[model samples]
Target: MPTLRRTHPADLPPVQRRELWAWAGYDFANSGYTTVVITAVFNAYFVRVVADGADWATFAWTLALSLSYLLVAVTAPALGAWADLRARKKFLLAITTAVCVAGTAALAACGPGSVALAIALVVVTNAAFGTGENVIAAFLPELASEDGMGRLSGYGWGFGYVGGLLILGVCLWWIMAGAAAFGVDASAVVPQTMLITAAAFLLAALPTLLVLRERARPQPARSGLWRTSFARLRQALLESEGLIDLRRFLLCIVCYQAGVMTVITIAAIFTEQALGFSTTESIVLIMVVNVTAAVGALVFGLVQDRLGHRPTLAITLVAWLAAIGLFWFAEDRRLVWVAANVAGLALGASQSAGRALVGYLCPARREAEVFGLWGLAVKLSSVIGPLAFGAVSWASGGDYRIAMLATSLFFVAGLAILATVDVPRGRAAARVADAAIG
Candidate 1:
């Protein structure tokens, strides 16, 4: 297995406050993309307008996202290894961010009967977003101590929700203004939200580009970058007994993150379809949910660092299960709102804790590559979870309630796998691996 020659954990560079915030800037920058385009505005628009409410529209949307995820799952691991080898996480971060911004901007051209244009743009934009997400997360272990990693990650994630809120809040105001002032309907104004989100992302990413420095030293260039990456990744996974716990935890991530992604991809559309929420109502619901999620991530970040990553994560999983149950039996919009809030609370913590735990278990010098693998795991869940939910909905003739309830199985599976992991042991193994590589 490839590993970095490095000093002990305490000997690493001290975290700079400016750099830390800049690092978090990427999170803040990108949340708007996911929140506005995929979760809040565009997905519903594609189904209701782009496809003109076709029966297969929901499935098609999920397929588009899953296809992007599939491409990431195939490419990110190798790219991660390349970034680690070349010390190019930031450079690659720039490329992916640009791709996402341009792709999201391109989404504005899609209106009714522009399903192909919409799906194609979504695929490119989301793929770029997912890839960049991996590269940015690779910075986590470099910037914070194991004890503080969860808290730091939470800060970024929680702050990211605020970013999402800003963009969505703006979109809401714009939609209302267009309705009242120009007498335009949502369909006419929705395209502008895409432009708004893309511009916000570009602005938000500037801090990270300017201030967040790359700490990983480049490896000696070797023959065949792709081959080297895959070989190293394969060797590491196959031979590193130290990472066994991390491997198990990855399985847990796959299961639970599926549930997370499913909810995110379907939130707005489900709200409108199942509970009679208008676009305005769905935006309001998600805005409130984002607030709760922000609180959850920040509070749980400290709690995880104090109580331990595993227990805190377990708590969030329990919350997810409860939320799923509530949504399943919800007979009214009020009940659905309750469930959405419950889910919002779990959303950030579950994702933040999972990523932090992976960082904890990762050996020195393997941050990007492992996170790439982590991205692969997450994208795989993205492919499976949302696609599964959409499939169930399609198969059941749009029985979205049953589809939503069935998602509980993912969290349950994640909980069962999570029980088997030993957190302290994993961290110890990582330290030992770093020393061994050195």
Candidate 2:
């Protein structure tokens, strides 16, 4: 018999590389929807135009965000467990992606004075997007080894920011020139922009469906989705004596992610309402942030491998605290631009590091189930952070600066918890778990 040859690390097969790109492509595809629909264009448009310029616009927008996340928080873990047990991550991802694309397209019909329709669409689309995020993340450990996981996760995040920038640029150009260049009426600009967003998401996501393959084996049948999910979750939390570090690390993510998500959800509105930025200026600022964020994700992702996930995350959280401080003190509109870039760096690094850490810590057999819990932590933050920001804004009579500063406490709290996590211990535990399962 002929001797088999071992492939070296530097000589990974082209097939593997292609699959990696396809995985990253999903991030690129969905980011367009996030940047234009959720983060930048439509969010502002909904508050300014669709809501008829209500005094409570900021509160209402944050409330809607909270509700959408609440839905995700309640369902993500059960769905994740079900997908894992059934070997259906790719199938479910497709269904959720379709929901996001369709709901985004329907926003074209939500003209001004369609606040109810706009809210409904945002809620549905956001929930779908959040679910897709969790499912897509479940593929991370399968795509790259732990040694290179940081780089791969970072690449995905970097690609996502690039996609966000490209889509935001397209929408900005349309808004600036649509009336004269495309014969679009000013009244129809926002609605038409929603159509553009939907198209971008649908087109960009095609590669993921074509190229990405599921690697999970179907687990034994369980009594029910919720029962299996809860049992597995409980096992990971309580029965596994070695997962204490994992448990602590997840709690840390919940605290810091609250600050991170609040900043992302509110950045556009804060700039528009407090600093008086025009629609074009706000989009441009976000574009600049995206450029820096892509750079940050790539740079910090490499750094994460060398410095280790815990140290890298702690540094990112400090950056977050400083950025929030700048937002609180920024009076000149230009100063807000500076803060935006700082926040962008922290945003990319923290997210990339967090995902890599979880990929490192989770057992291979439990990728979907564990990442589902990760999604749960993130969704829970979405609910708490936005609600807290909205409440502060409402209580302060819409003093968004105070509300923004309040987010710092979450970063500080998370960092305190992160300092205690033993990275090597957690990783060893995960390996042991994987061995037992194997």
Candidate 3:
């Protein structure tokens, strides 16, 4: 276990200082999965290479993700609860990351014929990666003061977008032109791609291990961790009338996140299958989206800090609706490129602001528990979103346009729900929760 080094609450004034950067460093670490593995490269590789000929591979992959997220939803709150009680955030984060990194690294054993093994590894990797994100979420309050949460969240999002973009660029170049540079045959490049990606995941984790300080002492016994976590989550959610606001937030997140996840998870498939782009072209398109997302994170982080989280998130919801509408009418690969960039912008804006808003709404003391619930919101949407996209596409005679159109409703409904919920009310309630807990 890493040593717990205490940071005084008085020392958190600089919104973008070293502590915050160390916090955001985790984003840079995890975005490799989102960019290179999930969005751009590995997903495409799976559908095109590993999962080919099993007409069921795409559906199976989606199902695997859905199952993984379902597990996350069930387990995250308890994990958060356990971490809080035990002061074991670092331990949990390290363990979960190791699972993900190991799974990602083991992808080297997957070849054209190892579909079952590939699926197992991906499932392990995805589950651990998703769960680890929740553990990382618990570390945020230690890194930033209350007032700085929005900008800090935005910075994390921005950093993640940039990191993912940079890594994806390298992976793409390696495929397109780096084979000769590395003295490797073009045929062996894909596995090498996985190897590089795996290395990135491990290296990215090192900063968090080295820099972020957790001052809390672990509970001696690790027994009943999951059960205790669930019990505490229930208590957190139902402990007081104050939780009603969090309920509203969770509901809104579910609807909007479903749309966001659908669009992002299905992007490469939409590009290649619908727009008739080749693998390399699809990857380049995904890269363009990520770059634009980095820009959007920067712009919106400032906007969120200025105009407030709800309005910024609402604007993102509107942008998401527009992006989906664009995709529905998308005629050529060019339009897909346009939609990808637009969606990227909205994706970054919403994620950055949404997380910040949750931080703002939850009391600092209860942050870990609340973040666990937030993780539940995130993972549950993972189940509904991608599965919905896949199911819609499957049912619509393979037309992805319907799936795109369907996502617009999610955005609109979520926006409406958010409009009714008062951000100030949530904040006030959270303060009460904090005082009571304190």
Clashes of each: 0, 0, 1
Q: Go through the candidates in order and give each one's C-alpha lDDT.
A: 0.88, 0.85, 0.78
Question: Which lDDT tens digits does candidate 2 get at residues 1-438?
Answer: 211121234534323677888888888999999899878988888877888788776567777778889898888877888888888999999999999999999999987788888889899999999999999999888777777788888989999999999998898878878867768655458788888889999999999987887777788755876687778777876774977788888889899999989888977887887778877787889999999899889899888878889888889899998888888888787778788899999999999999999988988768888888898899899888888888888799888889888889999999999988998999899988888877
Better of 2 and 3 by TM-score: 2
Candidate 3 C-alpha lDDT tens digits along 1-438: 221222455644333356567788888888887677777777767766677646987887787778778888887887777777778788888898888888877887777767788777877788888888887777666665556666778788888888888788888778868677778755457776777777887898798777777755454444576666676677766765676777788889999999888877877787778878877787778777877887787789777767877899999999988888787777776777787788989988898888878877877555677888999998898889888887788799998888778778889989988987788888898888778756
Please give the distance, in angstroms, between residue 195's alpha carbon in candidate 1 and its true position after superposition: 1.2
For 32-51, candidate 1 gives per-residue lDDT tens digits of: 99999889888888988899
Which window of ten consecutive residues has the lowest lDDT sum in model 3? 1-10
How do the candidates rank by lDDT, highest first? 1, 2, 3
Clashing pairs in 2: none
lDDT of 3: 0.78
Model 1, which residues run further than 4 Å from truth? 1-14, 221-223
Which candidate should be chosen as best, given TM-score against the real structure? 1
Off by over 4 Å in 2: 1-15, 182-187, 222-226, 238-240
- TM-score of candidate 3 versus the correct structure, residues matched by position: 0.92
Estimated TM-score per prediction?
A: 0.95, 0.94, 0.92
lDDT score, candidate 3, position 430: 81
